[model samples]
Target chain A: MPLSTQSQAEEEQYVLVANLDNARNLSNILKAIGFKDHAIFTATPNGLKVTVEDSKCVQANAFIQADIFQKFTIKEDLVALQVNLTVLLDCLNIFGGSTVAGISTALRMCYRGYGYPLTLFLEEGGVVTVCKINTEEPEEPIDFDFCSSNVTNKVILQSESLKEAFSELDMTSEVLQITMSPSQPYFRLSTFGNSGSAHYDYSKDSDMMELFRCNETQTNRYKMSLLKPSTKALALSCKVSVRTDSRGFLSLQYLVRNDDGQICFVEFFCCPDVEVDEDL
Target chain B: MQCVVTGGNVKVLAKAVHSLSRIGDELYVEPQEDGLALRSVNSSRSAYACFLFAPLFFSRYSIDRGLDFRCKLAVKSVQTVFRSVATLEKTVEKCHVELDKAKDRLTFTLHCKHGLLKTHNLSYQDTESLQAVFDKDSCANVFRAQSRVLVETVVHFPPSVEEVTVAVSSERMWVRNHVEDEAERSKALLTELCLAADEFDHFAVGAPNSITFCLKELRGLLVFAESTGLPVSVYFHEPGSPVVFSVTDSVLEGNFVLATLSDDHNLQKSDSGGGHAEPPPPPPDDFMNDDIDSYLIAMDTSVVPGPSTAPPSAASRASPAADSRTRKHSEEEEEEERDGNEDPGRPPSKKFRSLFFGSVLPPSPQTSTQPVTTQEVLASDSEDEDE
Candidate 1:
């Protein structure tokens, strides 16, 4: 049947508006609500054209209810997490199809609208040099929470080269630590655990618990604290999920360990040209 | 730099079979250039021979006078054999001079009693894009000749001969003069190929031109024949075995040697018969240079016995016997004495020696006109290996 003629009773169209970085996450959430394999196309400006099966028409609207948006908080451990430019540089340095041409092409196609005046720090021969984003400037700097409280979060290996990468980390049987200040945070993580490491101890006395909005429900306030990881414990394997907070910050939350383990987060904001719904 | 005479001067090497009857009814010419072409000619009707028409005048010291460069391109016989000789008949006489220097040229046409036979154009280029090599400064001169001649050649059948001894010769003077050194050239080629050949088995691909295993198999067959002096007949059914060359009717008839060749070689057989079939593209000629040199090592064990058959003329038999007896007796005596002197740990029996020595039939003194000289032996072995 031609899609246009299909009755709203038969199928529904969902317009998903989010930063492209969170496209896959929203897609999955929509899928879980019976919106399986919807025909998805790039939306005009900053939206995704999603066509749901008639069966999912009810489930999708209910899943994207206003309350879910209220529950969402794009949380970044804004202070604890730092955008170590080296990780992006290292990711870029990988040869093969990963040449500068590929990076530049990817930047032009994917990164241009997201940000600009994007300060890049490069270390060459042990000297730190700064690079400014050459293409159009990003509408605003990336918004992140920069809270450094979570001291013990799981190290994740989420790439095709995961096993090989972590074998190189040699992080097992060792106390891990990480420290970050609120001024700048949000590490543009490498696909694998291959690139960076962090270790820290979360003292019981420190502000150990904080409520963070998880995108799924307003009542789903994610609490954060840290526990000392057993040196004898092998690193836990985990999956990642991206959620937008009430404040409209896109946080990459590692839904990591199955039982609501620590959430290591990064925050990204949509391009300013994207007009947020005034009603929110 | 002082010029030293290489101490060896150009000598008449192999003589051309004077008449077509003296050679095979069909002679296959393999030029390094355009693969191989077998030309069929009527032996009784056409007189065939190459004459060296050059160096018409010779000074004991330097440049010879009256030398016919055109005649030097001629084919001739090395022996006073009784046969029909091709004679140069009609000549296009022309001479030119540039700045008072002599440039002489001649064209001769030949005729045979019967009709025309095939002539091959075998020029090849050294480059991938094969173009003729040219001396840009030299004037373009054309020397055209009709190739045919008649001679009443008599076949003097030796009394005890079981097979006809057809005389054959190379058209190229270069091949003739260097036949003795052919093995050396082949050997050098083989050495460079050893590693590549040895590693052939490691490659996943089927054998196309596997240098190593091919050499080993050829060597094995040759060694078996040489060890026993009994002709080694083989029926190779293996798909990978190279069975492109055949020398004796015995090998061809005794077994399925034809079946042993790669499918391509069989295709070549049919292609060979079709007169219009273009020559099979040759393996790179330079490649042959390397292959031949390395293969020369096997030459000692594999030279095909030349035109030797049962019946022998008294004179023809005499010289070969004298040469073989002198050479063989000395070599055997030395080998025997050395056996005694060798350490006991050395393989005590000569059985192993038979593996190599016996397969190579000592040149049959009674029938073979030429002595199996070391050089000739090496050349034959190399050729067999190369093929």
Candidate 2:
């Protein structure tokens, strides 16, 4: 409440500022895509977006819509800055991120523009702490150019099913092959590990499958290590949409519901692993 | 060979594979007339375990007659297929295991809920089944203790403890960990526990003896026993012979054989700080005197008394525990008296090897402290062949 009482002139100095009654709302979603260290933060009037990339082969984006925050303001048309995700998470959870019901940490995040540090004021149980994380030049995120119209195969399933499938995925396998088709063997996940090959299939009419649309059957292979981190998002989400473009690029969008029952989105885009026998 | 485990038994099969994985890197699966046998032997060849799954354990079972079906597969490969036993129990309805001779591979198919079918095909190598020759019925010392008793005692030992000595007498039994060599004493963490002989369901001690074995295999046994809520039956001879632990049910039986260490006896007479050349009690009645081949315990006196007086004590062990006791008692009555005075556990009435208790730092009484009795034989002998 004290943060909101700050003089309007002082608040105007910050090009971007947002406040939430519960810091976990921001910290939890950030954690969904916190697998990488350097995260590019883009603040626009719509909300805040955090993007993390790995080996230029995979990209993860976490979006926090404007309405979710208790107070949101943006003086600039677009503000992009990069910061260490691990450090930011540590500062946000400095109070240990109490999970007790009705106990929440108040967070006020502010950025003064380029060449300035991102300041965070966190309060828990009436005790206030401040943190200033230095920002670095933002790097452009790779655009997989995987649009909705180009999607050849798509399936929506409850998180429970995918969670079981992913948790048991063979880590020894170098790549995971996914087959999505309209007819027989509707959707399948296969892995070729040291011991042998394993396959898990899902019929279209299964109770867990919420939606299934396939214009053409597509089989693509993705690096297991690249897609492994997305299990964190899958664990927190309630529903997930899996799609593959005609180019064999993969996209996984998770509908994550935060602790406050507010909906948020985290999406992952990964380029397929090329087989040795396949001509370039 | 082909077998089908309908619903109920799939979980048991998975757990058996998991237990075999802990024993060795390779799994030897043998198909026989009566059932299927899964076996594994540690790389050091010191520990070997086998599980026999009867035909009743599987709903549908068949194997070609007069043909060898013994094949070895990487334990990890098969273990991966059965990973997550808890999940498998709930989702899987039936599991089929079939051997494909043409393809030279083994396939595991699981039919689960919601029309979901999962299949795994593992390639295996043809090999001879490793069989350990030991008579479980003739073991001198045998006892059946509840898994709870073993687990409670093992929990007191820190993970750093690699070996544990099981010392048993007619009246009492004890467990301890600490190598007696002075060089290893600084790093050796001392732990001792005394378990009453009555704690077991059945207890028998033909000869008061001590056997030191690795905890790694014991842990593997505990995993199987605790899960099935079955007591583990231990049968072993003297310190040098292999110890066999068995768990059984109406449909399944598992046997684990672990090699006992002989150097623990050597670790005894080699005591550095006992001050007196404690050749142990002159009488061999209470101490472990192996009539069988166990020269290490009998040969270590030379290494210990190398710089000290009484170099002949090294050659004394060559005479066996019985013959050596008479020789030592006559040769060093005075030294044995000093050892009896320093150690409260080692009474002259019992000729047991107090090799370890003699060096035991005054029982500090740990929160879970169990005393290292003179009769305990400091079973903490570590396996020299652990490598």
Candidate 3:
């Protein structure tokens, strides 16, 4: 269904419009970045980007390209608004076909100018549920400026492999240490938990490693609590790219495949937790 | 002390761990001369479940011969390693577990299909095993069937059902939600299923008997049995006796013993006993935990709706020979003897209530106590006074 088919009189009132045959394709990817309640929705001609931040330390951005949806339209050049992501997700799954097949909830999302509620038109099995979630003032997201040129070490691995590591991670540990080197242990994840210190090392030549590029031996620690939310994205992704900048800032890009087989991306940028005194 | 379970057995071990987690918060991992013993008892101490994975069950099994090896880890922590059995069966090639004396921690390392290794080091403390004593051979009423039959049957009953009654005569076995009395006949949601004795693979009833036991632990055991592709066998005597559900796989054996109600205990609170007296105190709660047993002994006798006053089955505490015979099952486990269990036998004599409870009867010395007959013991166990 396209916006042209709907009442143009009513559509003219909305500054932003997006439509999907199945709400799950949009909601599933949104759930990956929904660790927090507040989400900033940024719309451009290219696509819709949803950003969620935690404590100003970790920020997750999910990019849903304009092509992933059946109809994507924006009256203005840049339309940005903030709303409770948890509420949006609940509305998306209101029809409850997130997992079931043959029953899909068609979603039509619309937004007016500032301060207007974000209206959702969801239909499943001929029944419709309209949810109007209130919107809030959009806040500026932090910019890490972590470009590829500044990335000291980067590794792209099959999410299947990283999912195993993250699922079994010792949650008791306050921080997760990542080590990447050109020498012996090519990649490692270490945690010092209540029981003891456990390290998982993945050799550079391992089959699960899609690409491994390391120039210097770099080790950095990130708060496990901040990095933990990325596990949800890792579980839904097919491949995950892990990169650490020279300043110990970490960037994770997950390639998530929607139910329609279209490609989407969810990325996380995290600042270092602590620098241990290990000169000895 | 360490053991390695490889190939398909890893999933079985994980399944065993998952099953034990359902029973208790803590798991007692004891390595015996026979095999590895994992046991758990519920909080109220009404149900006890054990899995004895024989040496053959593991690809590599070894223990420190000189030092005593007994430690307990939180079941929740151990479960994180074996979170999903269906997935573990596919991705996990082998699971190596170790208890390093120097480290003093229980470590489980799972080697996955992609040469991925995940290790979980869980802190554990040295603890005593919770052992339950129940006589399966002496139980005149026995029922055996495929695991799915019971699993499917259990699904029909609502989850709120706390106690379930299985009544057996020579011909029929009636399984129904335990109804306290005729007054609740209309308002209560009752579900009943009747299976002929002949329907079971093996069924025998030497004497007419009915046992009302907690249904939570039984459902857990049945699901475990059904998943492991093993048949379940049930054996028990009259009410108040611990009903044992035994599942034996190729190299693994599990016994789930549940507490049952005696049906005859008349409540004095006049509250309609409306709450339906909490079955019986776990027969095994006495010897399983010393604190609970002694506390039970310390409780006022009349406050508890004792199993019975002078109905029948009461074994004498004076006979040691009968004691050994009744404890023949758990004797191999060598469960440490606890206080007040002078002679623990349920042989229906003056010994009364000794099977499920240690006899601390007859507060006969204290005049401050009520003047009731000595037939009723404290907490769930009742004995018949000498006629």
Q: Which prediction has the highest TM-score against the true structure? A: 2
RMSD (Å) of each candidate, 1 decimal? 32.5, 12.5, 10.5
- Of 1 and 3, the candidate ahead on DockQ is 3
**Model 2 / residue A232 / CA error / Å:** 1.8
Model 1 per-residue lDDT tens digits across residues A164-187: 222322232231112112211211
State which candidate, 2 or 3, has the greater TM-score.
2
Error of 1 at B298 (Å): 41
lDDT of 2 at B41: 68
Error of 1 at A239 (Å): 2.8
Pick by lDDT: 1 or 2, better one: 2
- In the range A1-280, model 2's lDDT, one tens digit per residue, is 6666768888889999999999999999899899999999999999999999999999999999999999899998899999999999999999999999988889999999999999999988888888999999999988899899999999999988888789878888899898899987789898888777888888888888999998777778999999999999999999999999989999999999998799999999999998435411
Q: Model 3: residues >4 Å from true position, as ranges?
A: A5-28, A37-50, A64-139, A164-174, A177-205, A215-219, A276-280, B266-387
Candidate 2 residue B18 C-alpha distance from true site, Å: 2.5
Q: Name model 2 segments beyond 4 Å from true.
A: A275-280, B113-116, B178-190, B263-387
lDDT of 2 by residue, B1-387 (tens): 999998768987888788888777888788878799898865434567888999998998999886766677888888777777878889889999999888778988888776666778887876533455456777778899999999999999988787777777775677887464567777777777888888999899886666677787788878878878888999976755568899988888899887665544534623332222222232233233532212212211211211223322222322222332232222232343343345553222122222210111111122111232322222222112112
True contacts kept of 2: 0.77
The worst-scoring run of ten residues by lDDT in candidate 3 chain A lies at A1-10
> Please, what is the whole-model Cα lDDT of each candidate in the order they appear?
0.20, 0.74, 0.72
